[model samples]
Target: MNINLKYFKEGLKDGVPIALGYLAVSFSLGIAASNAGLTALQGYLASFLCKASAGEAAGFTAIKEQVPYLEIIIVTFVANCRYLLMSFALSQRLNPKMNIIHRFLLGFYLTDEFFALSISQDGYVNPYKCYGAAIIGSPCWCIGTSLGIIAGNILPAKIVAALSVALYGMFLSVIIPKAKEDRYVFLSIIGAFFMSFILSFTGISSGIRVIIVTVLIASTFAVIKPRSTEDE
Candidate 1:
């Protein structure tokens, strides 16, 4: 085999873990989608194209609740907006001499895992390695969603209902660990929970409620919390 091909294959081998991880997480997303009255095609397509599980989940929730289109747009934006920062950071790691198309594609596939791995590479990153990682992981995400949706349809309603809660559990799993480390974050999370609970009882719609609560809390924290000069 050619040296370049062999090196690319090595990158694919490294992506095995990332692909497996994507499979599990997106499987949960599929269940969420199924529960949300989304079609199987919708579930897999969203996972395949967006490649951002959190954003997709937020969007799915909005859809499930029958929130307005504008609110859906806002929720998805707020959820996935962090990717812009990740992309900016990843951009600095690439060789300036690399192709612009490669740079664009790299940025496109620069998920949290792929970016971390690419940035860890010594010196300027080879775009091919990132491609290798994306090629493996992206398909796994889509495939997992497809399988989950399919399984949800075939399973009993009780099983599907149980699986749907996995989305909330996933969010908690992501937040609780970090919240444990920081008092501010912990407080913010607790505050958000209370706010959400309060909103549930009021005449306020889910769409407006989410927008109001998220903007209010996040902006307030942005002003009061400490700011760091370096990026995460």
Candidate 2:
């Protein structure tokens, strides 16, 4: 697979938004890592190795709690189970003729945003184009994580706390765009907030409560309003 200049340029362009979003989120991760007693270099290494926001967050939390290494591994794996579904979908998009090496390269770059962008494109993906996205996106993810760790080390605790809000803000930004296009998503957001608040007030364990409420509400709605054939 010869990746051309044009493909690389396109990947860089497509990756810009993701890079911007990642900077904030990765910075928060770095801050959390620092607070968890990890060195700046260790934080960067973890981000580079995992390449997953949720998994890294879970790992940090687990580490902070002095959880065993096996438990940390389990938590990280569980947090990233969605990647399995994403990888399965992407496999369907690759050219059937592509070899194992090509698949492996594509898998390396298979982040959530990258998968969404790749699959949303029409027709089968060119291996070079996938390579281009990886070339462009990987650095943003890595560099942001590195800088965030460095910043976390040098900055005051209060400042780090303030900057941490950027992670949630980034999530909101991502969701807002999608919610505008999908009424169901918008409603689901409202339902989630309401359920979370009610559960919190009632003294439920926040994590378990969220899982229970989300499952119950989402399942009930799914059953009551099964997707129409047209919607499907």
Candidate 3:
């Protein structure tokens, strides 16, 4: 088999399971988007542009609450800060011959799952393989979200309302397991709960409050939490 074909086939094989999982998670994102007053087309477009399930879900919620664009910007940056580190790590794995534009475009598919898989490779990563993973994974995410939006529109209003709240539960399911592995994460989770509770009583708009709480808590932990030499 051709070298490029071999690389793509391997990436596609690895990507298939991730794509299937993304379909399920993004489905909820679609429903949440519809509940937030976005049309199916808008929801699909938003996911395409944002390409992030957590940030988009949070942003959609903020948009529903009628926040200013500035708040949305802050929240988005806060939500996506982890990707900053992941991108740097992935860049180190790419060969020197890879074009800058290809590296930039490959970052589009660097979901938590994709990054995990890519970084686990034993040697220099193949750019074409990454592209193949993106090709398979990105579509599953986009199409799943579109289907969710369609389903959200079709369901009864009461049912849709019930389903919308599940997004929070979904977030917790992801966060709680990880939080259990680290003390700082657990403390941050608790801190966020209290901070959010206090913010609830304030006159600040919901979006601004979320943005402020996230930044404050995250920064505080960043400073207090011990950094690993590996990251240095």
Q: Write the per-residue lDDT of candidate 3 for residues 76-113, one digit (tens) a residue.
A: 88677667766877877778798878787778777766
Query: What is model 2's C-alpha RMSD?
Result: 5.1
Report the C-alpha displacement of residue 67, candidate 1, in angstroms: 1.7
Model 2 pairs whose backbones collide: none
lDDT of 1 by residue, 94-155 (tens): 67788889887877786766676566555677777767777898898898888877885554
Runs in model 1 deviating more than 4 A are: 1-7, 153-232
TM-score of each predicted structure versus truth: 0.64, 0.67, 0.66
lDDT of 2 at 2: 43
The number of the candidate with the highest TM-score is 2
Off by over 4 Å in 3: 153-232
The segments of candidate 2 whose C-alpha lies over 4 angstroms from its true place after superposition are 1-5, 153-232
lDDT of 3: 0.75
Per-residue lDDT, model 2, residue 156, is: 62
lDDT of 2 by residue, 1-232 (tens): 3445666666667666666666667877777786788887788778777888877887888888999888987887677766776687688777789899978877877776666656644467766655666666667677667777677655566765555564455456556766697687677778888888888888754445656666777777778666563442
What is the descending TM-score order? 2, 3, 1
Query: What is candidate 2's CA lDDT for residue 100?
Result: 95
